[model samples]
Target: MTYVLTFLPWIVYAVLPSAHWQWAALAGLVVAVGVIVRQRAAGYRPDALIIECGSAVFFAALAALAFADPDSSLHPYSGALSSGVLALIAGVSLAIRRPFTLGIAKQSTPPQIWDHPVFVRTNTVVTALWTLAFAVTAAVLAVLAHAGQGHSTAATLVQIAGFVAPMLFTKRYVAAVQARSVPQ
Candidate 1:
């Protein structure tokens, strides 16, 4: 069920090149909000605030772009990237919790930190920073689009290009702070 919403945008991109990206982006939002609610309802207090914050920033940035131009420059890629940023944080956190590698850390307290707030803020900041990058990328694309150049049609391609270093760096840093020792 979730997988459909997760990859549908990409699938849509491949099959229907002429489709409006905003529609797929809206669909992705609906799916993400629904999943977040479901997860919260299931007693999974898995840092919803940070996710919400990141989502808000990402959306706000898109809204900025949308305000720039309703007809031409309002690309779905911004909103999609916004949604994707939170999705990546959530997905990575879940993967760490389940039957996966680094399971022991899911169980250790860091001696360097007193509470989760530090890393929670770190994750939030990381996501927000990425969201800013998303905005910059959007601006670049918009300019190029106005100039009649570049692949602005590609959904969040700029983000994927710029996201790796920050994501990996933040992940490793936060994991160091929050990972628990496995109870043997």
Candidate 2:
């Protein structure tokens, strides 16, 4: 799903070894930029690339920092910072009344139903779940980083679960809403 693809850079960053954090940051920047270019070339509107754009900005800055000072103190807490940034982005999207999921969903959903109450509600709820997930993941990762276990298996598992749980919720929630709207 396009929604999942938006997180590919984050996934890349998470899986790579922290000993080579600069490389990981560079890789994330490259992947984020590539995803944005690919989606744009495929005719996706800017609105549909909210996460992609945010990712590009985040990764570019991170890469610059990592390269400029490879031994920066921020390196150890990059995971928590990443999740915190994501939470900020998602939270701001909701605050502005434009859940990022709405744009991604529009790619598959018919335009006729784009303005439907159920459709809007679905995106809102899904985005809220994602925001909560990111926030919680940030908190957990912060604790781990403080304990000097930022790159521990527990942190990695938490990151994976954070994305997976919200993804599953989005899929099932959308399906259930669609089913409810169907005529008996």
Candidate 3:
């Protein structure tokens, strides 16, 4: 669910034609608010608050741009701008020592293991990988957008790989560490 929410804005922007790109910010704002409300209603804090905040900020900026300069040329670069915002959010989370994954991991992990060195280290590494993926995705998307090919096949593949790579790595890395921790 969190993953879907995190990717909602990107999905929206990608699906819509270029002319509707500016509306992606509105779509993102709606999804972010829905996620926040649903999580709070269920008595569970959302695991991806950083993502939600980033979306909110992006939406606000877009709204301001629309209001201030209705003819601004930011619509074409919506994909790259969105990716850049996500990368910034992930990078900032790492810098603050509160890897965004830490919150998601805590939801499933036992409280006793929350402060364990292994757990902390695992999440840190996972978060680092996520940050790197976002950064690379942003760079690639930026280039594509600059070339007026943001919706090209290469851009789509890069976006898919960006999310899938870290997801697969996290699962495999966690399982391997867990297997090793179990003694004969």
What TM-score goes with each of the models? 0.46, 0.97, 0.87
Whole-model alpha-carbon lDDT for candidate 3: 0.75
Q: Which residue pairs come into collision in candidate 3? A: none
Model 3 Cα lDDT, one tens digit per residue, 1-184: 6666656666665665555545655666676767666656755555546676677677767756755665567765666777777788888988999888887777678889989998989989998998898888888888887898777877778788888888899899989989987898
Regions of model 1 farther than 4 Å from truth = 1-18, 46-73, 76-128, 149-156, 175-184
lDDT of 1 at 61: 48
User: Which should have the higher lDDT, number 1 or number 2?
Assistant: 2
Ranking by lDDT: 2, 3, 1
- Superposed Cα deviation of residue 54, candidate 1 (Å): 7.0
Measured by lDDT, the strongest candidate is 2
Q: What is the C-alpha lDDT of each candidate?
A: 0.43, 0.92, 0.75
Candidate 1 lDDT over 69-169, as tens digits, reads 54544453333444355446445544453211122122233535423455445544554554454456556555554555433444336535444545565
Candidate 2, residue 3: CA error in Å? 2.8
Clashes found in each candidate (C-alpha, N, C closer than 3 A): 6, 0, 0
Question: Cα deviation of 48 in candidate 3 (Å)?
Answer: 4.7
For TM-score, the strongest prediction is 2
